[model samples]
Target chain A: SQQGEEDPQALSIQEGENATMNCSYKTSINNLQWYRQNSGRGLVHLILIRSNEREKHSGRLRVTLDTSKKSSSLLITASRAADTASYFCARTSGTYKYIFGTGTRLKVLA
Target chain B: EPEVTQTPSHQVTQMGQEVILRCVPISNHLYFYWYRQILGQKVEFLVSFYNNEISEKSEIFDDQFSVERPDGSNFTLKIRSTKLEDSAMYFCASSEQALLGEKLFFGSGTQLSVL
Candidate 1:
């Protein structure tokens, strides 16, 4: 079974707008990491938030985690057409393996 | 920056034939992993290797699937007999550590097409 499920399976926004995607997991995790996959490409590590941390930022990317709710959200500010890709949240529990979410396909129209 | 690399950007094999996918992880990384993503499906974990042994594997990794770190720098996944359902994009990843919080670096992936 999948441990994490992403909401708004698909999203489309005009360039310069903000895009937010949410993910809910089924169990406690040591950390949660977000990744982006461009069409026909490999997964690209974006950012990671530890269980003890509530939020993290990198350039235009912001991620928030609420362990109490077992959920997390990824925000991309001032989106661009180059930001178009499928986003996935992976939850890491007490192991080296990461359980990935269903993913959210985001499209940034120019 | 160092990056994981996979060979044969695309592979085409017939059902019942054996196939071997190769990967070269970051030079100094100690943990290696394999993942597969079927078209229109989520990325699925296949197996994790550490200390020259398999640390963990998912249910999708069956007897027909095998992994080997043949030398110090190369990791390979071998499927004894390919099946049509096995066609997917196979990604190889590596991490500097085996801890839960370590980030992974993934290769571009090898698209497997089984006929």
Candidate 2:
């Protein structure tokens, strides 16, 4: 039941705009991972931010972790139509299992 | 980059019937896992496998479900007497090291429909 809550369940943005989503979990975690999934496709790894680290980046994706608040945020800069997908945050706490959030559904308009 | 592959992109089965979902994890990977997502729902972990044995399993993975590495390259999840609620998109993933530290490579996923 460590399921996290992702704000702005759905988002819409222009191609040149930036999209930001927030995730808040219920328990402490060692590392938090971000994943993206296109409709009907498997989830793809975007980035991973450890509890000790505050922020991590990969290409246009930026992930920030706030362990004290049990929350995290993902920012996509200059979004593209292809970047449209559901983004999820997953974390594990002293276990081999990962609990995924409901995810933020993003749509970028050209 | 090596990829995890799952067989039968989609599966349709009758309730009370048995269905086996097959997956071939990255050859060099040592850890395997199975996860499923019901339509419009969050992804749920079913089980994790390491060293040819189950490392961990969630409460959702009840006695009706079982996993096996029948051969060197294959990992399978068998659901006995499938129920309607079993319908979901099942994904298979693998990682070279412990998932807590390593990113996983996931297969395209197998859509299971229990009719």
> Please, what are the lDDT tens digits per residue for candidate 1 over residues B1-115?
8889999999999999999999999999999999999995799999999999999999999999999999999999999999999999999999997678788899999999999
Report the C-alpha lDDT of model 1 over A12-51, residue by residue, as the tens digit. Answer: 9999999999999988999999999999898999999999
* lDDT, model 2: 0.92
TM-score of each: 0.98, 0.97
lDDT of 2 by residue, B6-82 (tens): 98999999999999999999998999999999995789899999999999999999999999999999999999999
**Model 2 ranges off by over 4 Å:** none
Cα shift from native, residue A19, model 2 (Å): 0.3
| lDDT by candidate, in order shown | 0.94, 0.92
Displacement of residue B82 (Cα, Å) in model 1 is 0.9
